[model samples]
Target: MGDVIRTVKVKLDVRRERCDDLHQTKDQFLHCANTTAEWAWRHPDEYCVTSKQKAETALYDRLRDETELTANLVQKGIRRAIEATKSGVARLKNGETTSQPHFDAWSVVYDKRSATFHRDHVSLSTVNGRIECPYVLPDDPEQTPIGEYLLNEDYEFRMSTLQYDRSSGEFYLHARMRRAEREEHEQSTTAFSDAEHRTVLGVDLNVDGSLAVTSTGAFIGNADEMNHRRREFEKTRGSMQQTGTRSAHLSIQSMDDREHRWMQNELHRASNQILEEARDHECTHIAFENLTDIRDRMPGVKRFHAWAFRRLYEYVEYKAEMLGIEIEQVSPAYTSQRCSKCGFTHEENGRSKHQFACQKCEYELNADYNASKNIARKLLKRLHSGQTSSSGGAPCQCALTSGTLNLNGEFIASVDSTAEGESTDKPTTSVVGN
Candidate 1:
């Protein structure tokens, strides 16, 4: 087994007094970080001379005295900023564009040495004093204990960031823990699971079918009720915002939190279900469209909420990694309208938003289903050719159309958009990493 990092989010159980203290300290920590980065940015000459250790050593005393933050937290903030500054300088040296990393008063980092976790409570050091907060899982109300990994004695606690969202009035502690993980890449060598035995699950995602269509013939994520609830919330938000009273505003905020959590919970369920499908079928690889900047190209009726598509892709990515399912992003061009039956591209082939009919041949299929097959074909080409770049396919002139929707049909909700893991060209097996 090798090292794998996992982030366990446990809500802080601090009362108002301690919570306020933590918030105040978080502000100071952010200010200290950004301020230090600004210093490094202005003094590029000194950057070459000063190592991260030297920069941190010079800033620690000044930051602690000025910001009233503790030693460890101040040092950590400055160290983080130094790392950012170093990155920016390197980018400039390489003739690449660079921008300074900026931070504000919303979140703070807590090094492993700065906190202690017990069975139920965690004691954290701040500028004021050591505050103890029992962690809480946001959606789970029954006070169910945190995950077993968090409590595992052998797990290494590296560092975590504590952030408070003003809109939801919730505190989140993202604790990153390290454990051992190892997987044998023996599929190609195994006699039972050779080229013929390998299963490639190609998935095509679209607004027409929120549930993705797969090459293996399964549609995932049919949560129309979720969409209905989102539309209702939007309508309610529109009506409520008109009143504009303080109480009405507060009620709206609470409603927004509920809607956001509901959407997140629902999407999590969908991601899990998708992973279960892969696991059950022993899917070795899952292929998806490289939907990076998809909105810029086709801002049409067939695009779902951008956040939903992005979040689903990200969630599926990490979840797939956990199940040892490899993920790759193929070219988005021709995935939607290209005919999988005969590789025909005709405008009339996509007869309707939901149906695809080929003009050259009598081939017909569900629009999304046809698209999924094309995605699978693209993946197969990559596999056989040993190419890693995006597929170099011509764009389809035909467009998938969806009927117009009024205000009621639109889904709107403010939600958490932080991707759990950082994007990487070289994929890693770990669940948590940047």
Candidate 2:
């Protein structure tokens, strides 16, 4: 497998007297970044300074003379500005309204050249000079948070960001770490190379209580809690906006960052849970509903909800790729309304908020779970169709906890119904198709 990059955040033990030096360094870095961003923002027509090489050539020496930041720090600021410019340009091209990127946050990016890691202390470059600061690590490595990422030999050190928490008056270093995938993952991938032996996991994203539901009967995240937090943020922002004070505006920015971090943390947890569920089910691939024109389908969904869905998918996509597992997207059509057991399709089948009951077969299950199974079946059908045309292979079959579904048009389950229509737990075959 290939290398995987992850970030670990650790609190720093900085002397109160030395904290001012770091603050000054952060201020200089912000000034340099904003200066570069302002210059790039002036070029609306040409969309210039989006490239690292062009940005360095145009603003590197100028920032060095204008700010007190060191050479590496100035380069990092330029890189940050270029990334923002590129994002802004892309959004504008997509007909989205966006303003020039601005950096008001109190954070500084540090690369290997500007930072040194020791056993217990880290030396960082500041405006004054290099200062050595101790890490707030526990006595035992196992007791440390993200200890594997911080102290493991397998992880290689990369760039980091220095951030100050105003609420706690603490300095934190978010260290980016890289490591290769485990050998077992490679072996497992090889075992799944045969299409006949492959298993797939399907996930359904929703804005209800559950954020994601997997075909293997696993629910990943809490959408209700996320929506509650979003509402709280909106209420607080509205009150602060009405105040019309500089401190209120600054508080709004800090609150926005906190909310974003919290949302991202939730999404990360959800994505990790999805990966675990896939592994638990021995799934070689994970399938999700295609998100194209999602807004048109679910017009009531808020912008942040759509953003969360996209970000969650991205997190899962990368994590799955690291383990050599493939990700697939299938058409979302009729997934919510179609019955997983009988393949009955009707709009009224999804009448209930949390439960789904097939109008034709009386099949009942959780709505999201039913949709997830349909997503899996759709992907299986698509894959099998291609395989049949190309290699004349056997039909695609996926094993559920209680049954096996053959994409050739039948579902074989261990459970069956008697003459009176009561479940008898006997083997039977059901005709199931799109």
Candidate 3:
């Protein structure tokens, strides 16, 4: 069976103008309530109210004559207030801690001088194209007048409505504004097949401008462009900080925003490219370094490392999911320092940035390649040992053709060339961090 997926969204504080309109609507409702109460007192036999609904209907009729506010918005406000009250009651029944009951929507009332809305006690209902809130309205001289309140300025508008499918017994709310457009492409629902059918691709990212992939060895790419832009931004920000001028501050802010947008886009593109290449090669599983603990391990300059590590992981996961590729996280301990050919671990083994020569086994290789090989080996071991959740689930291995390798006896170097008889050149080796 396929897994169930759902998308949840929350929209917070909206415009204040909508809120003000709601408040004014409430004030008109109270004026109607006071008139009804006075009529009921003078003619008790003719205007007898048995239920709250009766009073609410009367209030709605009176309010409709006084204001131009739409009936839909007023009803929506009343329904929201009632829902809040119901939610509070449910929480108390579940033995949850809660505060005292407060009025979710204010009721409008009229006095000799002006109209006002009181938050204490109010009954709301929708009738005859108006919202009816029948309650005793407060008449204080110090209180702000309802006529001064602006529509959509003090109150925000929210819509909530339920739709039910009788055939499927499914019910859901079709509410909230469309803030962002949804992608048209349908997502894949197939679960990943067993271990034998999948090949895991491990990727190692570093700040020194390199990307190491387990299956294809190492490639060069980095946040160097982002770093350069950031440096330029910092200079502008420094000048702005010294000047304390409005124009300089605005310029600095604009530059910072531009830099962030560019960097984020670039990172997304690079991560997606790498994942697509792996999928094209028939690798269904992807592995990455678990960088959560890296900050504690390396203390100083923690903020920089945290940002880079999080951005890389987020991009990889998002791209992998979109491509229907499964991702795994492996411990990053000693992946760079250990020898790939032989199982030897030593701090001095990696003497330079680009070179790694194991002291115990005397095996030497490019630093990035060594790390890639280690990552791949670790993933394979985990899969074979049944330590992974998706292990032993399927048996669909990809068929790969063998290639010829040219060996350089001088440095014990080996290079694999394509099947099309294309010649492979050895890379110029340079020692870094000597």
Candidate 4:
């Protein structure tokens, strides 16, 4: 059976005394981790992949006598520290030593064998003692509680980490678990899963907003409003920096976390809306531009920072994976400058910010819409050329679609097409002429 790894967050409600005990244990854990790392850093003769297990065994035997900590945690800390040092050495050997690993956080790692879970509470092994804490689950009426879900036969318990969130003053437990892959496809829910019915949805992400245009529909986010809010926050940060007071500096420090959370919510909402559009359109394949080198192409745009785009893509990616959708990121070369109609590339084709007009062919359309079509075409070419994912499935049929998707989940269109059995004014593949 195929496996999927997922991380779940649980809120920890422990007694004040237990909290203090856990905090002190975290200190000890970090201290031991640093010590192990430093020892590995100083001793180059004792490191080898073949003897890593032996090294861990020796460290385990020696650490137990030195630190008054649990057995599993000590092993994990030492192994993790050594692995971290090895990674640093590799990076340095590659001629890049901008930063090294630091054991800055205070936390405890727990394996499944040492931890136990009940319906809504959990017991963790700490140096002071085993502390029991109840967790708060999200408001999902359709799903069972996390604890009960873990107890199911199909689910497997995995490693977990208990950490203290200083800002919230509450304990949080993050558990990494796995489960057997579900059969979301072949159940008559989506066209991508059905062999005969398939379509590709091309998504274009811009600093102003995002556009997901498919054969039957398109989704657009409220990027302008989101950008406005971000700029306002940036101005506030600028003012705070100007004061240069201790309080101002503290405010500046606190702004990052708050802004990050806000950006995350905004991006998540946008991605969810796009996925909903794809589902409605029955699109099986989703294509996005590989923006790895986008920084060099368009620099100094705060909204287009690599992390922002990465986070947005990650949200869509995980959601897509859960639904059996095939996704690929094509190289971004001239999606914006090239004309989708006559294959003409010119510097002046996209002189305007919102519209694209081919100087040679005189074909005009929305700039993002044109880019979306190009992205879809790129993937279609790859699909027909026998460049499928490792599973090596055949290509899916798709139509070139165009339109606008508003934040209110409303789709306004200049051109639209209907899914396989739906009634609409337009036919699929109307523009691609396939």
lDDT of 3 by residue, 384-420 (tens): 5677645653432211111111111011111333433
**Per-model C-alpha RMSD:** 23.0, 20.8, 23.6, 20.7
Output candidate 1 Cα RMSD.
Answer: 23.0
What's the lDDT for residue 362 in model 1? 55
Please give, for residues 1-434, the per-residue lDDT of candidate 1 as tens digits: 44678787777777887777887898888878887787777544554322555665456546755786665677778877888888877887898877677887587888644677564667888878888888764454344324555666556566788888789888877777776443422432353242333345567776544556665445666646666787799899899999999998999999987886676666666667666655654566667887778788655423345666666666676556446566777887877677765678777777677777778875766677677667756765675455632212211111011111111222111132123211111211111112
> What lDDT score goes with residue 224 in model 2?
92
TM-score of each: 0.47, 0.52, 0.48, 0.48
Ranking by lDDT: 2, 4, 1, 3
lDDT of 3 at 18: 39
Winner by lDDT: 2
Check candidate 2 and list the clashing pairs. Answer: none
- Tell me, by TM-score, which candidate is best: 2
Those runs of model 1 whose alpha carbons end farther than 4 Å from true positions after fitting are: 1-188, 191-197, 301-304, 389-434
Report lDDT (Cα) of residue 159, candidate 2. Answer: 79
- Each model's lDDT comes to 0.62, 0.76, 0.46, 0.64
Better of 1 and 2 by TM-score: 2
Worst 10 residues of 1 by lDDT: 396-405
Error of 4 at 210 (Å): 4.7
